[model samples]
Each structure stands twice: as C-alpha cells, then as structure tokens.
Target chain A: MQRYKGIVAYDGSGFSGYQIQPNGRTVQEEIEKALGKMHKGKPVSIVASGRTDAGVHAKRQVIHFDSALQLPSERWVKAVNGLLPGDISVMQVDAVSSDFHARFDASGKTYKYVVYTGSIRDPFKRHYAAHYPYKIDIAKVKKASEFLTGTHDFTSFCSAKTEMEKKVRTVTNISIEQNTDEIVFTFTGNGFLYNMVRIMVGTMLDVGTGKIELQTIPSILTGRDRTLAGKTAPAEGLYLWEVYY
Target chain B: MQRYKGIVAYDGSGFSGYQIQPNGRTVQEEIEKALGKMHKGKPVSIVASGRTDAGVHAKRQVIHFDSALQLPSERWVKAVNGLLPGDISVMQVDAVSSDFHARFDASGKTYKYVVYTGSIRDPFKRHYAAHYPYKIDIAKVKKASEFLTGTHDFTSFCSAKTEMEKKVRTVTNISIEQNTDEIVFTFTGNGFLYNMVRIMVGTMLDVGTGKIELQTIPSILTGRDRTLAGKTAPAEGLYLWEVYY
Candidate 1:
C-alpha cells in the first residue's frame, strides 16, 4: 500500500465540521466519497491534521490516506478535485512514506481569526470575516496576547466538555495584528483543545474592548474554568491556516 | 426635494442584475423595496451610473434618488443597509444637489475583469472569480489590448442586440495586468456598449490562447459586426469597479 498526502482548502459554510457526522455533512465525508469514486468504489479513509468546527474555513489543511492502487500524483489530484464540490479543492497531493501520518506525526498547527472592526459593512467579505463595529483598544489586546504565548494550562480557554484529561498545551506563538479596518489574531501551538482558539480570540476581544484587563489573563488561566474566560467567538471567522511537520 | 447620492457594493451571484426585470429578482428592485419600507410605503426610484447585466458584480456603484422627506445621511445609509440582503451594502450616502444625476452626470466609468489561469481551483474565491485553467500567452493579449485602447466604433465588441444608433465610444485606458496566478483586465472609458467589456475580454482570451492573431483586433473593429469578435465572457468575472464624476 502507498501512502498519499494532500493539502486541501475549503469554504466551511455548508459543512458540519471536519469530522464525520451522522446527520449533517462534513468535510471528511465529502472528501472520502470523492476518493471512493476515484478509486472505483473502493472506500478510503483519511486522517486530517486537525479537526475544525462547523462554519470554520481552511486555507490549507493536510490529510493522509493509504491505498493499494498506484496512481500518478497529477492524475490523483485532478481526479479527486473533479469529483469534489466547488466549495472544496485539493491544493496539492504528494506520495509519502507509510510512517508519515497527517495527525499523529504533525509537529504544530497555526490558525488565524479575522475580525472586521470597521463601522461600514463589507458585503463581499462578510462570510470570511467577523464584523465588530465597536472601537478596539489595540494596546491592551497586544499586551494580553503576550501572556497567552508559551506553555500553560489552557483549560480556561477550552470548552468545558473537552474529553482530554491533560489540559496543558504549549502555545508557541500568539500575535495580534491590527490593520486599518481589521484585527487578525494568529495562534501557533503544538495542539489545540476543543474551542481553544475561539475562546482565546474572544478573551482577547474583551481585552481590546476594555471589558477585561491584561493582568487578568494569568488569573483566568489559573482558575481552570471555562466560565472565567470570555465567550467563544463564532466559527465563521476562524481559518485553519497551516499544518507543520 | 433633496437628491441623495449613494455608493453601493453587491455580490451579483444572487441577483438577476443591476436593472429591474419582470422575471427573477434584481438588485435595483431589492434596493427599491428596502427604500419603500424605510420611507413608510412611499416608493423611491434610483438611477445608477451604469446598468450591469445579470450575474455582474459591483465593487463601487454610484446611484442617486430624490426624496422630498428629509432624512439624515446616516439614517439613509443604515436603514437601506439594514433592510437589504447580506450580499448588498450601501458603502456611503451623501446629500447631493438637486440637479445631480447618476447616469448623465458621470464623466467616466471603469470596469475590471478577472480571469484565474491556474490548474488548481480556489474554493473561497470561486464565486467572485472566473476560472480558465489554461495556459495563456500574455504577450499576445497585451499587444491586442493596445490596439483596442483608442476611440473606435465598438460594434464588433458589443452585442448584436444593442439598439444604440451611435456605436462609437472612446476608450481612455486599457491595460492587462498579470498577477501570480490571475490576469486582470481593466478598462476605463467614457462609456461601454452592451457586452462590450465581456467581448473584449473574450477576444483577448482568444489572442492569449493563439486562437486569433493580434492583428485580428483591428480587423474585428473594422468589421462592425458582433460575430467577428470573440465570445461574451461569463458575467461573474466582471465587476463595475468605479464611476468617476
């Protein structure tokens, strides 16, 4: 069997999430179905680098699958893309060793959350950006983001129903960039818990809006309670930027 | 009566076009309905700088409407935006002179046509851009574009159904820009005839693909027949970029 790795980009508006779901559609199921068609009805299972929630977009997502059938790399890319919907695209495909896994072998991941802070609404960019019409204090958000970087217990930043026992995760980098009319928060980490990035973005938004102080970040982390942090931002503004190995 | 000029932007994928049509929804009808709702059942008529065909988007479209009842600029901007669908937005609203008009008072108009010439598809930008997925000769298209710059009778470049008696229009500037994976054709003119920009883009595509020679542009213009020019490009790739006073 040959192992194949591919990078995908998708508009997650119509998807339930990255994982397979029973009732609603998911990105994983759609790709698998396309792959089955290309492989002459042979079912193929794919493992993704990370699972993004419903309404979250992906600029570049990595996935790996194994198959006995040998196909040219270009043909594989075209065949899979031809069967998929217009909202999903296979950006790149490559042959990899069997030991290379998309999820388990990944070293780190990066995500970007875009917030449109302009008073005027942007019709074309509405789906990809979160509209927050209020004025933001950039200095506070910048100071707060420094506290979020490095290794820490991120239980306060994750959803309460996380299944993992270990709530500690290493956030290698966290940066807040403010443009003329938009605020972008980029997070790089070894791994992320359920809703961790969204919750962190929400808490930073609160800091920028003066609802939370910069010094409260350490207290929030120590509390180890989801309620101690700000509300989780909506999923539409989040994008899976890249996966590193 | 006060004449208010507003700059609008819309994603044309959902509308029949800028003009009001008997069948299907139109952008003009939707905005008029929103205005009536905001004006306590009184209907308002809006005149736009130019009429865009079905599925043609607009980044900045200038329009004007007259109303005897005084309304604040912010109220006009906010109320129309609140009532319009998510695809449409009123970018700016300003009170104008009573004699001001949207169509007749315009000195120039600009349109941009984007063609994606990449092997891989872009899922996020599918609706906003046209995909060609073909190798193009940029030098040939650029040479053909220079020939189409000056004033000429644009009968061949316009649709046969156009009813204008005078087919002569001056093209002030015509330039082709090649980005990393996309080719953008921008045209600035006194005005454009029916399907003029699309036909020009299509003719340029033909030149880019070596289907037609660079010298054919002058002959096509001299032919004064629509069949002599290239096919009409899809409307989704065209955007009414701006209108100059």
Candidate 2:
C-alpha cells in the first residue's frame, strides 16, 4: 500500500465535527466513505492533523491515508472530490512516504479566530465570525496577546475535557489584526491542547473589553486553572488554518 | 403614518426568493412578520426596489414601509433586527417623505456577479460564487462587456419568462475585475429586466472562453432573441449590490 497526503477545505456548519460519530454526520466519516467507494467497498481510513470542533472551519487541513490503487495526484483529487459533498473538498493530493504519520509527524499548526465588532451582525458572516457588540481597546488586546506568546503550561487555556496528560505547549507567535469591524487573531504554535486557541481568544477579548485586567494574564497562565480564564469562545469563529511538517 | 426606508442584507441560501409566495421562506415574508409582531399583528407590508430570484443574495436591498408609530432610526433597525432571523439583517433605517417610494424613486441599481475560476471548488464559497473551471481571457470579457454597456435593448440578455413590455434599459457601467481565483462582474444600470445581469454574465463568460466570438455581441443585441445569447448564469452568484435614489 502507498500512503497519500491530501489537503482539504471544508465549511463546518453542516458537520457535527471532524471525527467519526455514531449519531451525527462528520467530516471524517464523509471522507472515509468517499475513499471507500473508490476502493470498491473496501473501507479506507484517514488520519488528520487533529480534530476540529463542530462549526469550526478549515482552510487547508492536512490528512494522510493508505491506498492500494495507483493514480496521479491530480486524478486522485478529482476522483475523490467527485464523490465528496459540496461542503467538503479535496484540494490537493500527493503520494507520501509510508512511514509519514499525519497526526504525529506534524511540526506546528496555525489557527485563526474571527471576531465581528460591527454594531449590527452581518448575515453573511453569522456562521463564520463571533459577534462581539461591546467596544474593545485594540491596544489592550495586543498587550494581552503578548502574554500568551511563547512556551507555557497552558492548563488554564485548555478545555478540561482534554485527555492529554501534559498541558505544556509552545506558542510560537500571536498576532492581532483588525480589518474594519472584524478582528482576526492568528495563533501559531508547536502544538495546542483541546480548545486552546478558542480559550486564548476569549481571554484576550475579555482583556480588551476590560472585563479582565491585562496584568492578570500572567496569573491566569500560571494558575493553571481553567476557571481562572475567560469563557470559551464559540466554535463558529475558529478556523484551522494550516499544518506545518 | 411615516414612511421608513431601510437598507437590508441577506444570505439567500435559506431563502426561496425576495418576494413572498404560497410556500417556502422568503426575505419579504420574514421582514413583514417581524414588523407585524412589532405592530401587534396588524400586518405591515414593505415594497422593495425589485424582486430577486431564488438563491440570489442581496448586499444592500432597499425597501420602504409605512408605520403609524414614531421611533428613532436606530431603534427601528434594532427592533426589526432583533425579530428577524440570523440569515437576514437590517442595516439602516431612515424616515423618508410620504411620496418616497422604494421602487419608483430609485434612479439606478448596481448588481454584482461572482465567478470562481479555481481548479478545485472552494467549500466556503460554494454558495456565494458560480464555479467556472475553464480558462478564460479577461481581455475578451472586458471587450464584450463594453458592447453591453450604455443604452441598449437587452432583449437577448433577458429571461424568456420576463413580463416587462419594454426591453430597453440603460446599462451605465459594466466593469470586470479579477481577484485571484474570483472574477467579479459589477453592473450599474437605471433598471434591469428579469435575469438581465445573470444572462449578461453568462454571455460574457462564453466570450471569454471562446465559445462565442467577440464580434457577435452586436448581432445578439440587434437580434433581440433570447436564444442568441448564452445560458443564464446560476442565481446563487448574483447579488443586488445597491439601489441609488
């Protein structure tokens, strides 16, 4: 069997989540079903960089799977895309080393959280961005983001449901950019625990809005308590942007 | 009673069309329902600049309604928006003269059609853009658009189901802009017949793809036959951008 790497983009609104579940539709289930059809009823499995929550979109999510069939990269993309639904697309495909693992071999990941600060919520962006009607100081948001950058034990910034024993992850960069009424928070890190990016964005928003003091960021990080942080942001605003190997 | 002019925006995916019908949800029905609730089920009606086909979005659709209760502009916007669904938004509200009419007082209108030329369909843009995979010459599109601009009898570029008696309309501008994988065709005109913008876009795309010769644009206009033009573009890619007073 030859391993193939593929890049996928999906609108996560219609999906329950990225992982396979017994009751609801999932991205993994759809993709595996498409691949299985190509394999002539033989089930095929896929490994993603990580699972994304329901309503969390992906710009370029990476995945790897083993296939017995031989095909060119372009044909693989077209053939698989033809089988997939309109909400999920297979963008690019390439044969990879059999030893390469999609989840374990990943070096880093980048995520973006979109915040709509408009006085009125835009209908088109309702499913893509979190609406924050309160006024926020951009400078305070920037200052708080600085405290989030770099390696730290992000226990306070991770969901309590995370199964990982080690809560430590290195955040390589945190950048905040404002485009008109939308504030985009980009986070680049070596690794992220469950809901880490959403938690960080939530805390920073609180800091920007003066609900949480900027100076309290250090304590929040050091406390290592989930309750000490701000509320978890909505899943619709988050996007799994890229995976680097 | 005071006439209130409102600017609205909507994601047309869930809506049947801009007008109210016997079945299926519509933007007009939702707005009137919201206003009816505010007026204690008195059933308020609104008149839009024009009707858009099913799956056609609206960036700034202008509408006017008469209400007996007097209220501030912002309050009107907030009250209506609070009652409306997430897919529709009330952008602005202003008190206008009793003589003012949304349909009759409009001097011009602008519509935009989005075309996605990417190799792979983008999942996020599936509902917002029309996918045209073939390579096309932008210069050819621009040249064809020039012939379509200004005063012309656009019978060939109109739907066969149109009930309008006059096929003449002044197309003030037709600008083609390419942004990466998307081509946006913006058309400004005094008025448009049924499916005029979509038909024009379809014909221009054919010219760009060499399916139709550039010199035949004049004949298509002179022939005044719907069969002489290209196919009508999909409704999902068309947007009512603005209505000018």
Candidate 3:
C-alpha cells in the first residue's frame, strides 16, 4: 500500500464541518466517499490536517490516505475530483512516505476573518463576509491584535465547549488588513484552539467599536477566562487560508 | 407627485432579465411588486436605462419612476431596499426633473464582461464569472479590441432580432484588462444594439484563440452582417457596469 498526500479546497457553505458526523454531510465524508467510489466500493479513510467548523472555508486543506490501488498522481487528482461534489476539489496530489502524517507532522496554520462594515448587506459579499453594520476604529483593532501575538494561554479566545485542557498556543503573527468593503484579520500560529480565531476576531472588533478598551486584551489573556473576551464571530467569515507542513 | 431617479444593483443569478415577462421572474417585476406593495396595491411604473438579458448582472442601472408618496431620499432607499429581495437593491436615489427619462436622456453606458481563465472552476467565483478553460493570448485580444473601438456600423456585432433599421453606433472606447485569474473587457459607447457586447466579446475571444485572424476584424466590421461575427458569449459574464446620463 502507498500513502498519498493531497491538498483540498472547499466552499464550505454546504458542509456541516470537516469531520464526519452521524447525521450531516461533511468535507471528510464527501472525499472518503469519492475515494471509495474510485476504488470500486471498497471503503477508504482519510486523515486531515485539522477540522474547520461549519461554514468555514478553506483555500488549501491538507489530507492523507493509504490505498492499495495503483494510479498515477495526476490521474488520482483528476479521478477523485471528478467523483467529488462541485464545491470541493483536490488541488494537488502526490505520493508520500508512510511515516508522513497529515495531522501529526510539524507545521503552522493561518486563518482570515472577513468583516463588512457597510450598513446594508452587499448582495455580492453577503456570503463571503460577516456584516457588522457599525463604526470600527481601525487603529483600535490593530492595537488589540498586537497584544494577541506571542505565546500565551489563549483560554479567553477558545471555545468553552472544547474538551482539551491545554490552552497554551503560540501566535507567530497577526495583522489587520483594510479593504474597500471589508476589513480582514489574518492570524498565523503554530496551532489554534476550537473557535480561537473567531473569538479573537470578535474580541478585536469589540475593541474597534469601543465596547472593549484597547488595554483589555492583555488582561483578558492573563486571566485565562473565556467569558472575559468578546463574542464568537460568525463562522461564515472565517477561512482556513493555509496550512504549512 | 415627484419624479425620482435611482441607481440599482443586482446579482442577476436569480433574475429572468430586467424586463417584465409573463412567464419567468424578472428584475422589473420584483421592483414593481415592491413598489405596488408600498403604495397599497396602486400600480407603479418604472422606466429603466435599458433591458438586460436574462442572467446579466447590473452595478449601476439607471431607473426613474413617479411616486405619490413623499419621503426623504434616504427613507425611500431604505424602504425600497427593505421591500426588495436580497438579490436586488436601490444603491442611490434622488429627485429628478419630470422631463428626465432614464432611457431617452442617457448619453452613454459602460459594460464589463468577465471571463475566468482557469482549468478548474473557482467555486467562490462561479456565480460571478464565466469559465473559459483555454489558453488566451493577451496580445492578440488587445490588438483585436483596438480595431473594435471608435464609430462603426456595428451590424455584425448586434443581435439579428432588432427591428431598428439604424445599426450605426459610436464606440467611445474598448479596453481589455487582465487580472490574475480573470480577464475583463470594458466597453463605453453612446448606445448598444441587442446582444452587441456579447457578440463582440465572442468574436474577440475567437481572435485571441487563433481561430480568427487579427486582420479579419476590419473586414467583419465592414461586412455589417450578424453571421460574420463569432458566437454569442454567455449572459452570466456580462455586467451593465454603469449608465451615464
């Protein structure tokens, strides 16, 4: 058996999440189904770099799977994409060492949260961004993001429901980018907790709108309390932009 | 009663064109229904800059209507937008002279046709662009476009069904702009005949692909025959970008 590595891109609008659930359609389930069909009804399993919440898009999600069927790497890319849904495509495929694990390999990840400040929802951008419909001070948002960079216990930015007890994560960098109709916040880190990026974005937006002070982020991180931070931003605005391996 | 002028924007994917049709849902029908509902079943009429074919989008389509209800321009914008569907919106509203006509008073218009040049369809841009999965030489497109600018009979570029005897129109400018994943062709002209832009784009794309010679453009324009040009480009790629008064 040979292991294959592939890069996946998905719209995420119709998917429940990346992982397979008992009752809902998901990104993982769709790809596995496609692989099984390619192998003539034999079951296929895949391991992904990580899970993305419902409505969260991904530009390049890494995945790995082992198969006994022999096919050229380029053929594997074409054959699997043809069997998959329109919203998901295998961007690239290659053979890899059996020891190379998609999730366990050393790497970092980057995410972007897009927010539109327009009063009325833009027809073209409604599906792509989170509409805030409020005044935001860009200076405040940039200042708040500075405090989030570096190693820290990100309990204040993580989802309360996650079973993981370790909340420490390293944030390599953070940036707030301004566009004509939207402001995007990009976060790069070694790892992220559940809902961590969205929570951090919501907290920064609160700072921008003066709901939370610029100085509030440092203290919130120090306190290690989820309730001390701002709301969890909507999942639709989040994108798993890249994963490094 | 006062005459009101407005600039409308729509996504066009859910529309059956801008005109009122008996069968399919049209953009005009939706706005008229909204106006009728606002006026308590009193039918309200609207005149547009021009009719866009089914699946064609608009960025600033000019329109005018008379209203017995007096409200501030801002309120009119909000109330109309609230009543309209998510795909359509009144981007701007203003008071205009009673003699002002959206179609007759217009001097020129600008249209943009977008074509994506990628092997795989971009899921995010599927609704917004036309997928052309072929190699297009940029230099050939630009050279062909240069001959299309300026005044011409334009009978070769127009649809065959138009009853108007005068096929002569002045094209002020034509530009081929290149983007990373898409190529946009912008046209500015005093007026256009039915399907004029799409037919022209099809002809130019053919020239770009080497199916037609660059020197043939002049003879085709001189022929002034609909059959002399290339196929009609798809409607979804066409956008009425701006209406000039």
- TM-score each candidate: 0.95, 0.99, 0.92
Q: Tell me the tens digit of each residue's lDDT in model 2 across B181-228.
A: 999999999999999999999999999999999999999999999999
lDDT of each: 0.91, 0.95, 0.89
- Model 2: how far is B220 from its true place, Å? 0.3
B136-195 per-residue lDDT for model 3 (tens digits): 988999999999998999999998888889998998999988988799999999999999
Between the candidate structures 1 and 3, which one is better when assessed by lDDT? 1
User: lDDT by residue for model 3 over A41-101, one digit each (tens)?
Assistant: 9999999999998899988899999998777767887799889987798888888999989
Maximum-DockQ candidate = 2
Ranking by lDDT: 2, 1, 3
Which digits, one per residue and each the tens of the lDDT, describe model 2 over residues A63-104?
999999889988998999999999999989889999999899
| Clash pairs for candidate 2 | none
Clashing residue pairs in all predictions, respectively, total: 0, 0, 0
Q: By DockQ thresholds, what CAPRI class is model 3?
A: acceptable
lDDT of 1 by residue, A132-187 (tens): 88878889888888999989999999999998999999999988888999999999
Model 2 CA deviation exceeding 4 Å by range:
none
Q: What's the candidate order when arranged by decreasing TM-score?
A: 2, 1, 3
